[model samples]
Target: QQQVRQSPQSLTVWEGETAILNCSYENSAFDYFPWYQQFPGEGPALLISILSVSDKKEDGRFTIFFNKREKKLSLHIADSQPGDSATYFCAARAYQGGRALIFGTGTTVSVSP
Candidate 1:
């Protein structure tokens, strides 16, 4: 089973509209949450992240809202652009050493000009 989950497997938006991506996790031990964006034929890259202690985190056009108690988080992309189109993955990592990040299925976002 996937420890992390994403909603709206796919999404589309106008160039200037905002795109919202949702994520949830199953492990309470997960203390770190990172959102990754991947372009076609490219590896996923970290976009933004938040710790369980934080309620919100933002970077430029991307923001992440976290709810530790509920084990949920959301990524908001402001000013959606066609070049922003890509697959987004929500991931979680525990303090356990020697472990790679666990990722959610993914959310594909398409921005139309």
Candidate 2:
């Protein structure tokens, strides 16, 4: 069964705007979250992430807003570009180690100029 869930299977946004992707998890044991960005025919790359201890993490135009209490999180892409169009997966892993990362269904983002 899928433990992690992501909203809006598909999204469209303007190039200069921000795109927000929402995620939530069912397992409280999960403490590490890493968002991945994948383009067609390419492997998914690590995007931005936030630990359960932090509420937010930012990298360049990408940001992850986390809510540990609610077991939810969101990825915000600022100043989106056409090149940013890709599928994003929200993945989680437990701190206990040795467990494989659980991924959400993924959100496909489209940036329109």
Q: All candidates' lDDT scores?
A: 0.93, 0.96
Query: Candidate 1 local accuracy as lDDT?
Result: 0.93
Candidate 2: lDDT of 78? Answer: 98
Weakest ten-residue segment in model 2 by summed lDDT? 94-103
Backbone clashes in model 1, listed as residue pairs: none
Candidate 2 lDDT, 1-113, residue by residue in tens: 77999998999999999999999998999999999999999999999888999999999999999998899999999999999999999999999969998899999999999
What lDDT does candidate 1 reach at residue 88?
97
C-alpha root-mean-square deviation, candidate 1: 0.8
TM-score of 1: 0.96
Q: Which stretches of candidate 1 lie over 4 Å from their true place?
A: none
Estimate the overall C-alpha local distance difference test score of candidate 2: 0.96
Give candidate 2's root-mean-square deviation (CA, Å).
0.7
